[model samples]
Target chain A: MTTTTTTATAPPTRPVVSRPQERPFGLIRHSLALGRRSLIKTLRTPEQLLDVTLQPIIFTLVYVYLLGGAVSGSTQDYVQFLLPAILVQTVLFGGMATGVNLNTDIGKGVFDRFRSLPIGRSAPLIGSVLGDLIRYVVATVSLLTTGFVLGFRVQTGFLSALLACVLTIVFAFCLSWIFVLVGMLVREPGGVQGIAFLVLFPLTFGTSMITPKETLPGWLQTWVEVNPVSHAMEASRALMVGGSAGTHIAWSLGFSVLVLAVFAPLAVRAYRRRT
Target chain B: MTFAFEAEGLVKRFGKTTALDGIDLAGRQGSVLGVLGPNGAGKTTAVRILATLLRPDAGRATVGGLDVVRQAGKVRRLIGLTGQYASVDEDLTGTENLVLIGQLLDLRRTDARARAKELLNDFGLAEAADRPAKTYSGGMRRRLDLAASLVGRPDVIYLDEPTTGLDPVKRDDVWTIIRSLVGDGVTVLLTTQYLEEADALADDISVIDHGKVIANGSPAELKRVVGGQTVLARPADPARLDDAAAVLAAVAGRPADSPTRGVVAVPVSGDAAFTEIVRRLADAGIAVTELSLRLPSLDEVFFTLTGRHTTEEAA
Candidate 1:
């Protein structure tokens, strides 16, 4: 019995091995890794990066050259007037890419994979939203560079111009959460795009992103004055043009806080449901 | 020994459709429990609950003594789950996928990289570690998925149809990996529609149909439940098939099936009946070409219990 046992043990012990010990990371670490992966994907796909860059440049040129005379009466005046509007409109439109990417990820079953892992529940949602900041900054810089080339001046000085640009991007970053919520709620990519367009088109185009609300019809003017996008655009315009801190600035800041409060939780809730 | 995983009266309903109806299961540590079922039989639902991915409408489940509902985080720490399809990010490389999972499970950056390298080498993916998962073959992707699940070194793993789409050779490769995992004392709950897969891997088999576990036991025990033994006989000569059939009929009380082509099958109850049939055939001077006594297979058992063959069911 002893001899037989020794022979059996020798063969079995040669093949049998121990399992490795596991060490789990915290939520913050996981969220950073997810964010890094998203950024890497953005770097690898330069062709897809053109949307945010081109839209800001083309729209700034078109409004500055073609519609500048009709709207603001002078090219320089239109450049000053339309630059801030272009900043707000371009950044807001840039936020839509987040929804589209999220929709694509969900359609491809990427989110389902995240569900099975032991990672933080909020990591994917938060990381994806944060990753789009790269695009927002890219669009903002391209629009600013184009406006500068066209002889547009920032009378509020370099520091204030930088702050205004930051505010516009930050506001756009906040607005992306609303689209992230929509993306999480809708599973299909096309459906997400349609929902995003329906929500964004009127909000940006109908508001004061381009012209002052005082120049519109009485009923149309009333709606535009209260619109959150209008408030954001007007506040941003004031900051760039060396205007006073008035109701538009107060309303824009208030609207930013309100949008974040309402949509952040909704987006997180939708993300939980998705998993 | 205490069970590695247990579920008691697990009931889950999606809208008005009852997916699982009071199912209970207890699996021993370091053993493979194969769940055999047709489609819509709640096999996936049971795995989901055990993996802490779904909540039961009513019931309790525990992994390593941690409640799946009340202590989901702890249960998740102890368990790893691989679903029907490969669930890794296709945009990431194989190494990136495994390392990401390791990092999520809390490994240090260096440690995660080391673990990822080891897993890639172990799964024979070292050469393709840097290639994006979208470029991998089906077998490679499946292996990477399995490697991803093992990144946490889970005490118990839930594999729901791990070999659903693999060819015969690749399926056998996965079976080898599962055996190694069990050797390391990891308890596994495997669900699959292929009866042969269950026969190959399961130490204990549970047959589920229509949201209920109709049968559960060791493979040999369940096969015994079907009936006694069957004696199959085939004639050497095609023309003399009926003669052999008549001889078998006279010996066994139960009528033999008609000689199809040149073979006749007769079901026998016991060794005595089999011996009598052999004696009668010898005495008739008819040389039997083939004679064998065998118990029913799991396929037949499924048919006998469910009143339908596995192939006929749209699983």
Candidate 2:
């Protein structure tokens, strides 16, 4: 590729596909093709949809009805306060399936089939992430619809609400790399679930999703301020409910980039090592 | 001339266990090389190395003259692998599985679909092409697995114990498919524990045991190395077994073996020995109900080569 000689430029005599370098955007092409497979798998198995669809609706219902009064002083105020953060939490939870499904597939023939092909080693991992991106979108729409039904109104314009949805998905997509790394290293599918829950509970719960930052004690308040999940949720709430979201949005995007930078390489490397 | 695929001094170990210990295997262009061995004897390990699934600790392997390690990507482009367990995506229908492979190979979407349809029809999976592979029978699943590999139309293929668990009829179906692949000038490296499978398909047989090549030759050559053609005679009178044995032994210049009740069989190096035995048996006034001459079975050759029966080790 550095110095293309005449022989290199000449077409191959064999009808077989040329070298990997010769195929432009081979990574993206293969990854999207695999992503379509994951999407079809999702469509075929309706039960896997329950997490993105029902979990958000059920969580919104129970949270607004049961804990809404005690936390926000009224169910009405709580729906507005809780729904946006619920969108953040639900999408993050839905993202967990990427790792779980990947871990399950590693022991199956499907993973080997992907690895044996002459494609990018990271295609399967990226394809799974891309395929699971829909879950976050589903959670966002489902939670937002439930919120609107429960008397939550968007103070911001349509553009801002849409921005919130996109931001929530981006943050979730970034955070899923951590689970993908775990999935690559862990041997058993069930072990992936156990570790995912262990990491996710603290990451998602430590956020400012349930209550305002002011209500927490000194140490917890400071931790929430630094937590990226808290920033993502904060940015989501502001964009949807109307507030100064400039700082939160910057923090969320910055943290998302940082997490993706650190973990995406690590996950793909772990995949190569594990396989 | 270079072989279609070859492995020289391949050595691989897992912790304390040596899975493949300097095994040499090769397949000529447009022919089959059968790596025959019992379970844990490293047939699969050797195959994995040649398929670029595993790297040999010390050895050189090439497919169509491209080094497996240094040019693994290029190797993948030229080869296909079908594991013992059919590796088709069970969730997808047969058509989708093949189409997925086609797309991975960078075929146009319409071309991929057309290829899938053709392979499905060719493999007699047309009716089940729309059904998820998980629902297909075992034989159908194997056919789809094979079809998936052929999507790229590779010149060399590695079938690692491709018929390990299949029934008799299903195994024959696979053998026919392999024959057709070879008919198209594709080279095949087949591994199997079934002696008959190798005998039926391989042009060359490499008998492996405990990660080493203990014996290597054509089927007829390996049988000759172990011994030679055997002449058998069943006495018309069960009481005359000893007389028949003595007559055959004298003519062949070796002691005859009574492998079964009332049947005396002796190893003979040539057809002359068989005719001599017939003349001698008649001279001794021995009437035989059955008489035949044949090469030694691969089962016996395997036993002679390894000094242990496959059934014993397999069990």
Candidate 3:
């Protein structure tokens, strides 16, 4: 047994090591590490893949077979028009998951853990968005492959088709910041889900995703014309099927940049304010 | 001597309600400062501010001579915080959670992995290291969370009611772990509703109520605030309690209180008081079943100081 010593002496305070000072670009390194964490989480729970994987395939196949003859005279013709719209819908839904996941993390005290760490303040927010890029890639490939199997050919060159896929993924990544902002302010995953969809559902459906804007009523067409989703879909459609895509691509990119500028800082600020 | 951490006139408000009203805290390096408070006493708020999780509305706080708000990143490097809830990622395995924290603290991948393994083994969680934290028992998850905080070997650790929901066995284990950390010379700021916990572990205790420090001292000092030592006895015969009480009163020089059947206790002042009571009881032919001279319980001290009952026992 140890002897009891009550000397009234204060405990010794050892010098703390100040090594491993935060290096330059430490934010990027920390974000990448957290991104890897999100990726591993996705891998473990493969069900998180269902929204990006199964939704695209189902939407492409069902739309082409069920509404093809009625809307565009042939399933082949309809697949050409519907594939990009389906991909856009898939990515939009994919973006909502970012908010839901972030809300869940905040509610679970995971964000508190991150905040107490020495990492950059913005790392967790940026990392989750970066990791979600994989979901977009998964959706894009599944939609394209299913359309190709259904006899939908990309008239544009492979380079243009690749650009179309990249455009949708980038747009979705930008939109995720908006959801991240919502996630930070909201307290529950279910609440985030409801609010995000309430904001997104009208935008996706009111646009020309399921039908041509010209075929819609005047009031609806007016909204569809200004809808960013329509611009993104038009950009993807023009790139995949041969057309002059410069204006649509510029509009899509410009809109995404504007959203990113407005939402990124707001999301990060909200995150910092939370405990 | 420089404090490991200190907060002066800290104030935080949520809407119209002030969560912290000029709360002040100071802790010496390598010493334990136990923050004892009932629910909604702003203990967590104070810890959060010191941990750099939230900015105070007014007043200044520092960790290791760095400002909490202006130098939050540096302060973060100096402190490890285990919040009131287990903050480990439920979706990640125990090993993964620790490694993630290690890497976030700027450790290389291999180093993070090695540290993660070492922490898991040290916390007796090697068997469940690969299992998702969601599957862990409450105690296991708390261990993993604490392990994550220690991965960076922070100079100061903030344990915010870490043992709140734990069973006694698990709580003892946590206490042992905390003692070892203190032995390694890490400064600790622990917040608990359990006064006994503070008495058992703290070098000094601060009792907070309504966002203000109501009492601050060592356990013995706080006990003295309530009263002096008490002599208690239970006679072998219920009828002999009166004789025992009279003997105790004569020796203690104060009237004894019979709190329950066959039990009499009275406040006593000196060491000779115990011997005097035993001699007097024997002379009076009072056979005692139980006898002891003990200080007042922390519960009594808390009630005497705050004039309110504790919501939970100091287990």
> TM-scores of all models?
0.83, 0.87, 0.86
Residue B144 CA error for candidate 2 (Å)?
A: 1.1
Measured on C-alpha atoms, candidate 1 has an lDDT of: 0.78
**What are the candidates' individual DockQ scores?**
0.27, 0.28, 0.37
**What is the DockQ (computed on Cα atoms) for candidate 3?**
0.37
Q: A16 in model 3: Cα distance from truth in Å?
A: 15
Each candidate: what lDDT? 0.78, 0.84, 0.84
- Candidate 2 lDDT over A1-275, as tens digits, reads 23222212232244333222335688898999998888888878878888889999898888888988899899999988888887888998998899999988877866766777888888989988998887777778888888888999998889999999999899999999999999999988788888989988877888778888788899998889898888888888899898889999999899999999999999999987774
Candidate 3 residue pairs that clash: none
TM-score of 2: 0.87
TM-score of 3: 0.86
Collision pairs in model 1:
A23-B106, A24-B105, A24-B106, A25-B105, A25-B106
Per-residue lDDT of model 2, residues B131-207, tens digit only: 98889988899999998888887778888888878899999999999998888778899998766788789999999
**Tens digits of per-residue lDDT for model 3, B1-315:** 868899999999988888899999998888899998877889999999999988999999998888999999788877888999888888899988988888788877777888888789889999999999999999999889888888877778999998988999999999999998888778899998876688789998888877888888887787566555778899999988788888888887767776557789876767788898888888888888899987644444455676545554331
CAPRI grade, predicted model 3? acceptable
Residue B187 deviation, candidate 2, in Å? 0.8
